[model samples]
Target: MNSITHYLHNELPRINAFLEAQTARLDPVVRPAAEHVLGAGGKRLRPLLALVAARALGCTADPYPMACSLELLHSATLLHDDILDAAVMRRGRAATHVEFGRTGTILAGDVLLALANRLVADYDIPRLNAVLSEAILRTVTGEVMEIANVRNTAMSEERYYEIITGKTAYLFQGACECGAILAGCGAATERAAHDYGLNLGIAFQLVDDALDYVSPSEITGKPSGGDLREGKMTLPLILYLRTLPPDARQKLETRIAQDDLDAEAARAIADRVAASGCAEATRDAARGYATLAAQALEAFPASPERDLMADMLDLVLSRNK
Candidate 1:
């Protein structure tokens, strides 16, 4: 685990440098907004998966530029999502939309999307282009579905899975699949890469949802229970609701419908979720996905990159933020 951590610590900066260069290409007026968001660092999990996948397949390609492009797309999504969620903080800093006005932030996001497309266009691989485009399309569809379902406390577990899988998991799947494709791996190996990333991504998001209830704002990069405050029904809350008796469930639903979603209300709801044992339930589901993610590596030979991915699965399941 320490070795894998060291490798990631060394490699992430290269990706960061690549991102810095890519964002530099934007107009000076738009550059600050893009740079601000880019500079606010994240786990960079999607791009890391790409690099690891390429390495696991023994590909000689640099993989950095392609990996960086995926990060650009992800940052763009975060910019848009903050606006949609009316969020103020991101990565412990003001959200791009909060720092830059809505119009400017929107343009910044568009610039990122355009730059991402431009980067892949330079690769001139039709299949790579298709994978990126499909990922974006699926992510957008999932966002729209989530927006349409806002405040729907009755949102089913099945629907929640569909939303998170499409919005989050598919992008990770595309990144790993594209990485394997760049490595010129066999079809079976490419399928394994996709599966590994897909399951990892699901586990990642599940942990993120769990963190929202248990982690502090300093760690989570946003306020605790922000999902519930935004009326987004995540798995913990959904499962917690199921545990309630009919009248208790109705009262909780009524409480959720109350206006303002003040701090007191958020904490109250979070307390209920904690006492109901739903956080543990959500973690168990995340463990299931992590197991699937680990299994996906069975087809690949033993390598530092593969071992790094195995360690990452543990990190995802155990992460508090």
Candidate 2:
């Protein structure tokens, strides 16, 4: 396994233990649903970021609770998002809503959110609760905004950035900030870590959008053209639409506006977007964000932890490429 995967494998058991111990005290009905969602596999990127950021701040304290809190918050968001998007699959299996039913999934997600805040409240770290609370609110708002923009062909680049920053980057920023807070780091260090995670998160999402256009269904664990099928306006399609001649743009828009998207037509549009260099443009933007993320770490003293964080930024781009 790669470094991140290896870290997760080693640390997640401890985090899971912590979660189990805490949730054991909760109401019986809520426990099973929370456990089910928690046990559902994920990349655990937010939690890993929390742990790494703590380490980067020169702390040796166990980051298990903090990491677990981050993971809980992330998982809650995923549950809610899958329900809102009507996403059928998650981690190559039925989504939480698909398997548990919509109301059950919503309840599960709410439980996770409450559990995450409860975990945060247990931490003795000053201001951590306020930061995490704000982050969660922002993330929810971002999701709502994105959902509102869905299928709106007139979505602009600026609006897309706003949605992505809120939906993804804020949680990452909160993870790093919480890490630094727990580690008793100074404000400057906390801000640096926040910037690092924020930029990395943006880059990660950009690459994810790119992957939707290019990666095989098996590798991506979703059908190819999933974004197009859902009529979600992503970076590549947005850029591609701008580059097209007037008539060509009209035809593409008409196809996209259809309720039942034709797979062949979607594939053809993806091919045209690829041929038009929009994917490359989107990639360039991702690289720029990766560079910014690396630059955010310059304040920290040179160490393996710092290097790993920088490597993670590169990994974000490399994964989708």
Model 1, runs deviating above 4 Å: 258-260
Tens-place lDDT per residue, model 2, 187-297, is 898888888888888888888888888876777777777788888899999998888899988877877876557777677777777777887788789899888888888
Can you write out model 1's per-residue Cα lDDT over 29-114, one digit (the tens) per residue?
Answer: 88999999999998888888888888888988778878888999999998899999899999998998888899899899999999
Cα-based TM-score, every candidate: 0.97, 0.92
Model 2 alpha-carbon drift over 4 Å, by segment: 1-6, 19-28
Residue 98 local lDDT, model 1: 84
lDDT of 1 at 7: 81
Model 2: lDDT of residue 115: 80
Clashing pairs in 2: none
